[model samples]
Target: QISEATDAPEAFVAKILQPLSKKGILISNKGKQGGFTVDLDKIEHIKIIEIILATDGEEIFTRCAFGLEKCSSEKPCPFHFTYKPIREGLKSSLSEISIYDMALKTEQGEAFLKI
Candidate 1:
């Protein structure tokens, strides 16, 4: 249902399912008729950060935009001030939202993972 709803290939969706299963975001079953399922409790608690970490890694949050040798507050990049707040907002949003919230929207037809 998730793959279909997202309009993604089953293989691609299966790959994504790997990290979620590893991080305990979801549990999957096997065999002729088995599939993935989530513990509602875990779904509600698993933040987007956990998903991103399980799949995409956290380098995005830690890296300097310009890739400068020294790009900290003491010797900031040109975009540091401008990018900092946006980054912080992204971080906050990722941490604040849980899979349950997204699932709810999808379930209600308020949003779709794919057009």
Candidate 2:
């Protein structure tokens, strides 16, 4: 169901799902009648950054704006200063928006979940 919703390949989705299950973001059952299910209340309490870190790792918090391999505070890229605040703002915003809020927005037709 989750894979169908994302329109992503099962193999790829499974790879991501495994980690989430391990981290208690998802519950996986083992049996013929078993599968995975999300605890909406629990998920609602989880910050988006947790999911990002679990799935994409910390690179999302540290990637260079110009995609430079050596960019940093010392050897900063050309766009470093300009991009720093924007990235920080993104991180802050993402931290505040929970899965429940996103779901509510989409459910109310105020957001797009499929696209």
93, model 1: CA deviation in Å? 1.2
10 residues in a row with least lDDT, candidate 2: 34-43
lDDT of each: 0.83, 0.83
- Each prediction's RMSD to truth: 1.9, 1.7
- As a TM-score, model 2 comes out at 0.85
Query: Candidate 1: what lDDT?
Result: 0.83
Q: List, residue by residue over 12-70, the lDDT tens digit for candidate 1.
A: 98899888887778798899987788887677888988888888897677668887767
- State the lDDT of candidate 2 residue by residue for 58-115, as single tens digits: 8877889878989988999889988988889989998999888887887799987578
Q: What are the TM-scores, per candidate, against the unseen true structure? A: 0.84, 0.85
Which segments of model 1 are wrong by more than 4 Å? 67-70
